[model samples]
Each structure stands twice: as C-alpha cells, then as structure tokens.
Target: MEPIIIDGTAKTPTVKFDSTTGVMEIKGRSIPENSIEFYKPMVDWLDEYAKSSKDQTVVNVQLEYFNTSSSKCILDVFKKLEAINKGGSKVLINWYYEEDDEDMLEAGEDYESIIRVPFKMIEIVE
Candidate 1:
C-alpha cells in the first residue's frame, strides 16, 4: 500500500504511514473542518493493510490538541487496531504526550482501558 503523508496545517495534524519501514506515525494538532473526510482514506488504508499484514503494526500518535470530532476519528483508528489484533496480527499503540499534559495522558489511559490491543503511554519531556 502507498504511504499516507499529509503536511501539517494550523488545524490539521500530519499523517505519515510508511508501509516500507513498518512505522506509521501521526503528529501535530488536529481540528479539521471535516474530520471524517480527512481520516477516511487513512482508515481505509489501515483496513487494507490489516488484511495482508505479516509484520507487527506499530502506531505512534503525538498530538498537541484535538477537537471532539477528531477524538471520534482517533477512536475509529483504535477500533481498527483492535480488529487487527483479533485477526492474529500484533498491534501496538504508543501515545505520546507532553510531561505536564495530564489531560492527554488521561485520554490515553481511557483508550488503553477500552481497547484490547496493547497500548503504551509515553511521556515526552519537553
């Protein structure tokens, strides 16, 4: 599958999905006008990748802020990962947050509690 790379904008985060190196990362702020539109292809690609994936899938997410709609999109991403995990593929999620951002850390913990996949919360000391 082709990589998904979107340049970061004021209200939208960058998405980089590199199938070659087995590293998929999403970083930056997220508050897009149309959250579903921005995340549709990404979800589709992930769905496709999950079908034929042999290597472990690692998703790294680092965001400064996101809107409510973006939160839904993120949950969708995790749901996809959960499906992949149930399909017998190894899935790992690393949620990176600033040291003092307890809100983000709590959000990560919430996701970790709900999702069956392996989710790791990482502190990024700035």
Candidate 2:
C-alpha cells in the first residue's frame, strides 16, 4: 500500500500514514469546513491498511486544536484502529498534548477509554 501524506493547512492537520513502517501520524489544527470530506480518504486508507497491517502499528496524534466535527472524524479513525487491534494486531496510540493543555489531555484520556487500542499519553513540553 502507498503511504498517505497530506500537508497541513490553517484549517487541516498534516497526516502521514506510512504503510511500510506502520506508523501513522496526524498533527496540527483540524477545523476543516467539511470534516467528513477531509477525513474520508484517511479512514478508507486505514481500512485498506488494516488488511496488510504490520505486527505492531503505532499511531501518533498531536493535534493542537480541533472543532467538534473534527472530533467525530478523529474518533472514526480510532475506531478503525480498534477494529484492527481486535483482529489480533498490536496497535498503540501515542497521544501527544501540551503540558499546559488540560483539554487536550482529557481528550486523549477520553479516546483511550473509548477505543480498545492502548494509548500512551505523551506530555509535550512547550
């Protein structure tokens, strides 16, 4: 599978999904006008990747901010990973949040609770 790389804009995040390494990353702000449209391809790619996933897949999410719509899309991505994990592959999520951002930390925690995949809350020192 080809890698999926999308550059970040003021209203979107930078997404890098490396099929070879099984390391997917999403960073920056996500407040796109159409969140579903922005994330559909990503969710589809994850679905495809799940078929030939690595023994251990790591997803790194470092979002500075995201709107409510984007939050649902983000959860969709995690749900895909959860399905992959349930299929016997080891999946790990590294959720990065700024040290002073309580909301971001809580968001990570919420995702950790909702998704079956294991999550590591990484506190970034701004």
Candidate 3:
C-alpha cells in the first residue's frame, strides 16, 4: 500500500502515514475550515491499512492546537486505529506535548482514557 503524506499549513497538521514502516505521525496545528474533509482520507487509509498492517503500528501525535471539529476528527482517526488493534496488530500511540502545555497533556490523557490502545505521554522540552 502507498503512504499518505500531507504537508502542514497554518491551519492544518502535517500527516505522515507510512504503510511500509507502520509509523504514522500527525504534527503541528489542526484548525482546518473543513475538519472532516481534511481528515477523511486519513481515516479511509487507516481502514485500508487495517487489513494487512504491520505487526506493530506506532502513531505519533504532536499538536500545538486544534479546533473542536478537528478534535472529533482526530478521535475518529484513533478509533480506526483501535479497530486495527482489535484485529490483532499491536497499536501504540505516542502523544507528545510541550512540558509547559498542560492543556495538551490533558488532551492526550483524555484520548488515552477514551481509546483502548496503549498511549505513552511524551513531554517535550521547549
């Protein structure tokens, strides 16, 4: 399967979904005007990847900020990964937040509580 790569913009996050390495990452801001439109492809790709994914999949999420819609879309992405995990592959989520950003840390914790996949909270020094 081909990889999914989207460049980040002022109002969107950079997305790198590598089918070869089983390493997916979304970084930067996520405040797109159309959150669903921006994230639909990613969710779709995850669905496809669920069929023959690697033994272990690693997801990295590092967001500076995101809107409410983007937050829901992000959850959708996680849900897809959860499904993949349920199917047998090991899925690990690495949630990165700046040490001083309590809000981001809380966001990661929130997602961790909602999703079944194991999550590692990584504190990044600024």
Among these predictions, the greatest TM-score belongs to: 3
Clashing pairs in 1: none
Candidate 2 regions off by >4 Å? none
Ranking by lDDT: 3, 2, 1
lDDT of every model, 2 decimals: 0.88, 0.94, 0.95
Clashing pairs in 3: none
Model 1 residue runs over 4 Å out of place are none
Cα RMSD (angstroms) for every candidate in the order listed: 1.1, 0.8, 0.7
- C-alpha positional error of residue 60 in candidate 3 after TM-score superposition, expressed in Å: 0.5
Which of the two, 1 or 3, has more lDDT?
3
Backbone collisions counted per model:
0, 0, 0
Q: Work out how many backbone clashes candidate 2 has.
A: 0
lDDT of 3 by residue, 70-103 (tens): 9999999999999999996899999999989999
Q: Which stretches of candidate 3 lie over 4 Å from their true place?
A: none
Give the winner by lDDT: 2 or 3: 3
lDDT of 3 at 46: 96
